[model samples]
Target: MDLLRSLPLGLYLEQPVTWLHRLDPRVKMAWLMSILVTPILASPEWRFFLVLLLLVLTLSARVPLRVWRQQMGWLLLLSGLVLLLTMVMPDGLVVAQQPRLPSPAEISQLTEPFETLPPLPQPTGYQYVIYDRWPITITQRSLELGIRISTLLFTLIYGTNLFLLTTAPEEITAALEDVMAPLRWFKLPVTEIALTVTLALRFIPLVLEEVQNLVRSVQTRAINWKKLGFRGSAQVWLQVVERLLENLLMRAEQIAAAMAVRGFTSPDEHKVEWHRFVLRAWDWFALGLLAVFWWARLVWGGEA
Candidate 1:
């Protein structure tokens, strides 16, 4: 049930009101962007450093341990799964080819291997028999590449999760709108887009809650799953999903109706009241730290 409740990634922690939660949304946005962009073209070592940096930030934010435990568990599981798959799956070099049973000539050549001649040009690629049957060659380069890719993915996702954990939907939309405000000069519908994003973010948690409600509702009925069989159980789940979608649609319509009643018909008439983002000394200090991150990325980012 707790895992189900944590389905929505965009949930904001409202209580505790940590410093990260209180940071100016626009500044937070800047920090997010800086962290997000700096990792591109970075080596595995740099990405690992970024992962550590995220850990340090998460610790400093003072968000409750329980709040992030499930997330961290999922992240670790996901990362391990990815790494395991990478290790097990051979690289592109191991493409399928017609099976090559030892030919008479090859067998004869092998049987006559008494000559300790200078090592023949290293075979184009390694081919060693595994279990004296299946042949496989593991390449160091391929393994390193896979590990690097997995680490990169884990670091990027965990950092984004940290941002979503701390920031509110309204703050996210406002920060985006503020950052993209200059685009209005080009006659872009920035306000409308931002508002649309805001509504979408606002509904994410509600949709997750609706899912939980549907699950609980089904559970409360005490359906005998052992009696229903696999097909019946799947059908029951499908019906539940169908109802959930219908409820979501109905909820969306109600919201639309309410907005219409409140005169939210036109983007021009709709005004967004932004939570004022006053830059203080801490904000500057944060920016300075970001600058240092950029400098570090530029200088030592090539080492893996």
Candidate 2:
């Protein structure tokens, strides 16, 4: 349970503020968008570079090595499993380009002198023997595709983890609001959207805490899951889930009531006070980094 609580994947860490944490959240958001979009057109080689770049950023951020180590094990395991699956899966049938065997009439014509005709021209393309039944043969194309996909998966996971690790919930919401402020001109409910996201992130830890508490309560009561049998165990789980949901809903209602008391009826009427985000010198440097990434992508023409 402790390990589960301390998984550090989605949870935010605030201690020992690093340069990454001090950087403007909007800059971080731009960096994240670049990391996500650059891979779309990048070749396998570039994707691999992106993965390495993720590692480099993590190191430079100076986050605890153990935090990344715990996540790396799982990420590598998943990537390896996906690669194994891709390698073993048979690609579409490849049609042989070899010409058909020479007709018997042609053979007879050639052999009219009653001498063995020279062996017909060998097949021009690949030929698989009937007895050669290899279950899976990986091609270079398939390998390249698999590598690209794996790198993409790793990059997304690690990049998002990096952002969430270094950024606070409030900072994320504020950054989002700043980024999406333009939408307000088009009559979009940007504030409401940001609030929704903020509430969601804020509730995650609470929900997890509730779940842990529920599990501990059940264990303390000495519920015999084994002896309860399958049906009984299912019923118990359902009840536990129901209770958890009820508690969550009650807490939500309490929060809503509290907010109402404080005059938070609507986004338009009750605006969330956000620290005005100003782009610092480092923020421009971050944008420059994004520009460089895109320029490289354009020059390299990310192709398999």
Candidate 3:
């Protein structure tokens, strides 16, 4: 199993650079933040809109069908499962109410000419329970909760995935460092922080590679898992895990040594400008659209 190609989360797409890739990473970061933050306490309609918006963005960007199909297919399935589970679960809206009718003893004590009043009719056409059956009951609140949860899950994971897919690691670090420049006034090690982030991002692929290699090695050995039993399999995997950690540490040490050999002692002294930060026409247009997005959200996205 090729983990790199099969699971491409947080991995940037290098070929077929789309307009999304060309846009300033900083602007993309802002838009990503907007997509992630707008779902809080939002109406179900708004949350659904965000889900559609992310899908639209992915489609418009023309991301490879193979890439997004793997990413979104599983995510959509998970969201649907969550929605179904939530719909069947209790919504916590049940409350005890005093009966309108008096008890038999109390009724017997009533005045001589008293008669029972007619049952009152519902004033509105609203029904809280949408469906009822022997084993399953779905209420309006439960449905709303399902929609909210499913949409939020889709929005959070897919939104961040799209951002990472379009934006490169260098671009991400550059954008973050630029945005965090203000923290320098407080004597924070902004450059060092940026360097650390850059390394961390770059190290993801290495970690995946190590895992893939170890799994392939284990497969080539053709170990009889059925014969080995659970305890044997667990012990074998424990050794693999230990070796994986050692290899990762060695990789990190190699990277550190390479940097030192290249005369890179400190981040502030040996700063590497990965990408130039410049807002283009498309970026300004995106910012304008972002303003409109927020305006619409504030005006109509609140819960009923």
Better of 1 and 3 by lDDT: 3
The candidate that wins on TM-score is 3
TM-score against native, each model: 0.79, 0.86, 0.93
Whole-model lDDT for model 2 versus the true structure?
Answer: 0.81
- In model 2, the worst 10-residue window by lDDT is 125-134
State each candidate's clash count. Answer: 0, 1, 0
The digit string of per-residue lDDT tens for model 2 on 160-271 reads: 9889989999999988988899999999999899999988887777788789989888889998878999999999889999999999999899889999899888977877
What ranges in model 2 sit over 4 Å off?
Answer: 1-4, 94-99, 103-136
Question: What's the true lDDT of residue 298 in model 1?
Answer: 90
Better of 1 and 2 by TM-score: 2
Q: Cα lDDT of all candidates, in order?
A: 0.79, 0.81, 0.91
Candidate 3 per-residue C-alpha lDDT over 214-290 given as tens digits, one digit per residue, 9 for 90 to 100: 99999999999999999999999999999999999999999999999999999988898878988899999999999
**Full-model lDDT, candidate 3:** 0.91
Candidate 2 clashing pairs, residues 3+ apart or interchain: 43-302
RMSD of 2: 4.3
Pairing residues by index, what is the TM-score of model 2? 0.86
